[model samples]
Target: MADREALINQLAASMGAGGYAQTKYEESRYDPDTGTLYCNGQIITRNTIDLAEGFYKNMQAKCDLKTPEGRQMAAIYQVGIEGISRLRRAEK
Candidate 1:
């Protein structure tokens, strides 16, 4: 993996990276420590996993209701998850 990354970096450098060290574009993922998800230079999801049942229950019990923004995000993620799960079931 290290060699692969080094070779990619070298190749990219040879071709003028244009600020990309590895891939031509970059993507980010959810960071547990920050409780957020960043992708393509913008934050697409925040407090993402808290929408799950257990975590949501815990937050509700603690009276940690979210603001309007969080609620909207939660609804979106819930719908997306349901859709994906349904598709997986159909595939099986």
Candidate 2:
């Protein structure tokens, strides 16, 4: 198994660069009252972590790594999705 604490820290760092942590914690706030994480101005009540992982998998499936540009973009997307996973694990 992966070291979840480390992954969470890493994700927090990545998201913090763009003020995502501020937005999630201060502005959006996870509502224990509703058991939801407020994100992008929406109430994300369920499977936020799964959704993040699934999004990366879906993108990987769609991307064609036959070209240099495609490979580069896919790599970037992979990193982005990994950040999401870190965040989700941290939240849990």
Candidate 3:
């Protein structure tokens, strides 16, 4: 229970900074027993994380890292992937 709350707080802080509404995080719930997460009453599935990682990899493969724009985009994707990974870890 502590772990779940801590992860929710951390996620709220990080995502709040990224311009997401506070209400969204406030409504987030995690079921440690089932390892499931729900945000705004919607289930967050493993497939979502997998798709984000796939998008990041695809972007990295197609984008030129030498360009500032490419690097910025990569950073955005990386942050998202890291956030999702954190959520997964919290479930465990």
lDDT of 2 by residue, 1-92 (tens): 35885576468557533333345446655544334565774445547656767888788768879988889879988896886655556555
Separately for all candidates shown, the number of backbone clashes (residues 3 or more apart, or on different chains) is: 0, 0, 0
Q: What's each prediction's TM-score?
A: 0.29, 0.48, 0.57
Give the worst 10-residue stretch by lDDT in candidate 2: 16-25
- Give one digit per residue, the lDDT tens place, for model 1 in 1-92: 98998787777557643234523256654443444444464443333433454454544444423777667666655566664345334433
Which residue pairs collide, candidate 3?
none
lDDT of 1 at 81: 61
Which one wins on TM-score? 3
- Each model's lDDT comes to 0.49, 0.62, 0.65
- In candidate 2, the residue pairs with backbone N, CA or C atoms under 3 Å apart (3 or more residues apart, or in different chains) clash, namely none
- The 10-residue segment of model 3 with minimum total lDDT is 16-25
The local lDDT score (0 to 100) that residue 64 gets in candidate 1 is 22
lDDT of 2 at 51: 73
Predictions ranked by TM-score, top down? 3, 2, 1
User: What is the C-alpha lDDT profile of model 3 across 8-92, one tens digit per residue?
Assistant: 7678557532222343557676554544566774555556657877887777677668999988887877787787678678876
Whose lDDT is greatest here? 3
